[model samples]
Target: MKDQHEPKTQSEWQTNLEDIGAKEGFYEALGDQHTALFVERGDTLIVTFENLDHVYERGADRMPWGYDFVTSRGWSMLGLMAHDWTWYRDSEVHDFFDRLRDEGFFERFSNVIFYGASMGAYAAAVFSSAAPGATVICISPQATLDREVASWETRYKKAWRRNYHDRYGYAPDLVADASAVHMFYDPRAPLDAMHVALFRGANIRKYRCRFMGHRIASLWLQLGILKPVIEGCVANTMTQAEFYTLLRRRRENGRFQKEMLQMLQKLDRPKMLARYCTAVLARRRGPNFRKALRAAEEQIARTNK
Candidate 1:
């Protein structure tokens, strides 16, 4: 049976949460939330470093990509939600991890998977060391936005203000002891790709998600492969080949199909474009592909003249 730290009433829970997120530079459910409730339910736990915007975008009710997969079977979730992209370096934040370690929080779970995307991914990689043998699945995670180490990262300049040399600063160094580190990012996103390149070590498993943009997590979710990929990561069984095979599902994804059409049209091979579009239109009826097929036919006519 799974255990839960049930509050007596919804209002009580709301009141409890209020005392939690009211401080500046302080975060949501950080120091005040019940740590026991955080990992009380299951043998498997998913730790996520999240931004407040994500909560606003999806609403707090929406679970992160991997949480739903393990909930039915009994798994715990600890979302280290940041009020902003603070890079998770506050003194209280470090203290929270200290408490968890002293209490042997990681020891309670048989298996744990730490997950996040972008800045959150950076935090996951850095914090994974706390759990020693746990798996870390991060998408487009920065190695360090610290100006000293990565002045090339012109984007998120605000994050550079925070000190990355602090306790859990360098992500790559922090993740060395983890059982496995699975990082996904698009080689086309120069900054994200550059960041991933910096996060190198023998323990890392790099998954190249070409042309997917910096929102690799969003793309995976759109293609309906996010959950299963995370499940594989948690179970320590997901491989590069398996990830690509699952990626084949993107063949029907509207966004991918549209991007592919644009890429093909950019090649200027009207003849081949005509054939590819005809083939795609025959299998699936996409408005964008059909329009491209028409445009390709016109281009061929113009070329033939």
Candidate 2:
């Protein structure tokens, strides 16, 4: 496959697609082949493989793109699309990566940081495991397919079983082989918390947060969590201690305060909202923080009236 970055025009893009189809055997077989390039001054490249299930619908914009955060740090971004809620083996995804490897796309880069949140996290963990010495960061990852435990299983029953046979699921087995793995989860989310436990024996690090929710970790991109983690991975100096500190700080420092306040207001829980906002404001003191607290207060006052 040619570098998707080389396609400069409509005709060029079409021709590139045709070439990829020819090389890969069929265009329709490319389950989720969306690629974007961000050029920056750096020797390290971050290849973020997004998870399955409504990726194009929900996560296309959420996953770190546009190089806003990465470019400033002098690192480039490569985003990969997965099989979309369907269970696919690492070989299937690596087939795409192998093509890029053969074309010398990753050769110029010195360090590669593989990141994904949720199911995408599963993909990142699986793909990075195959590489000799690659760093992987997964947030709210599912270690195995437990139908009774996974809330999303009802929506993705076929995909879950298809990926996991009678014995093991993807992340639980693949994580053992990774060079370094960082798994993050919220203790409140039982499924994700259980998923974090599967990486106990390997070079895996675990982080547990309170009330941060499943998607909170991926928001690291927006909340400024990706920078330090990516930098640490590249420099080989990142520790779980530092990673958790960042996670905890982001949560307490007004990252989820607004959303929690909104939820509290909608549920007509003014007292809870006030208490939560008070705690957040106490830790995070600033004009903007106060503004958010006042906004929550206004919502509570309005709802009561």
Candidate 3:
């Protein structure tokens, strides 16, 4: 038999949420589609949105994306989980938020911040309207899936059919009353860039991640800058200069280097590839870099001959 204290399995994670909910704040099933898990800590609250599939994929013991991070700072957390990629478009879910707003739940917190990535980011942005002055930090968030507003969006085909004409429909418009909105996305990602373009207002602050693509959140986590970036945002201390300075940590990241090398290879620039590999190998032992450098040298020699 497994130890009672052993890490909870994927299914058990759901059970665990229920258990925690029974003891602490509350965990309510919004509908057959979504669930809400609230854990109170400090006066500040970090509201996060996540896909249940992604949560379970993280292995047994892992919690929501910002669960550990938020709690570590002694802040409260309200994790909104979607059963699938429904984009959290459910009447029950809307009603739940409406209830929370009516009860002045958000007003209890000294500060409130809505956070997520991708689809979750879209939810975070749209839902921040529930608390007018809340700050929003999202990565690669879609402004809307409404075909009328985002005709060029070919992705999230299922979501295209969902209604974006009602309350909290247009993410960009919903976030207009927010105290601040920070958007992170790679300008290199055509679709992502196009989606972000719909968001306009003085409250919007866009951070370009360049070649980082649509999954800049994961990359920032890998580079060990995710937490600091969030901390800065929460504290209202994040400046463009400070963010870029923290982003420099990517220079030593293997994945970052590999992606850069792949771009060089795609451009057929062996010289730049060689120099990149040499620089990486000089500072650290990278088998991939070493191998690429050899191939680049061979290509250069053949071209010279």
Candidate 4:
């Protein structure tokens, strides 16, 4: 609803999650501790890690926000929201997942899809370990923000202070038995790419979304393939080819067109930039493409001179 940025304060963010959960008939559990909410609407449950910023921006009217793309397929929703990148290390958070396992909650569902990006992505990968046969979709997920383990990763320096050696600490170690883990990250983002490198196992399939940086999920949301891909995961039909086919929508998407245009310009590939702009222009009339086209043409004119 509002521009989707991380919320500035926890009070406002928590309030927003509560408000939306209430309006959507989603019951809350341990909100003060880990802020978990779930709606039991169907046999298939989609467990998602909702960052505070995303919830505060996308309110209740748009029920099941982050998983909006896939939730429409009639799957129940379980939301495990965090205050920050708590890495879900809190005792309460740990106990919550343990209790779920003790109570056999996840097994009740016919299928479970755990999803998140960045900090939440780390949590998704970590906690999905509780459900042996669930599907995992992590976008720009960190293997661990722990400085000790990820000392090579200089990014998220603020998160380094947290202790990542505790239970469910190492993200890669957590998903040993998941049915399948799909990791997406941009190689251009050295930190994210490095994090992807940590998650190794026969079950893990890493997809490189080059140039799409740490917030690739936001970019895919613009391209409109985010939902279809996740839905395919739930349906057990999302192959690498199907995901790429869905990603093809980016060819006409304004965000992808502009990102590619900017990169091509910086790379001094004027001819390629012009070609990209012309292709996008033929499909849609937009200011970004028009301006990029002009810039690329000007660069070409200078080059020819």
Clashes (backbone N, CA, C under 3 Å), per candidate, total 0, 2, 0, 0
lDDT values, one for every candidate: 0.75, 0.61, 0.87, 0.77
Candidate 4 stretches greater than 4 Å from native: 1-33, 59-72, 284-305
Give the residue spans of candidate 1 off by over 4 A.
1-28, 31-39, 60-67, 265-272, 298-305
Q: In model 1, what are the clashing residue pairs, if there are any?
A: none
Q: Which ten residues in a row have the lowest lDDT in candidate 2?
A: 24-33
lDDT of 1 by residue, 215-258 (tens): 77777878889888988888888988999999888777777767
**What's model 4's lDDT at 39?**
65
Choose 1 or 2, whichever is better by TM-score: 1
Best by TM-score: 3
Error of 3 at 189 (Å): 1.1
RMSD of each: 5.8, 7.6, 2.2, 4.5
TM-score of each: 0.82, 0.62, 0.92, 0.83
| Position 234, candidate 3: lDDT | 91
Give the poorly placed runs of model 2, Cα more than 4 Å off: 1-43, 52-78, 87-94, 97-109, 146-155, 165-169, 251-255, 258-305
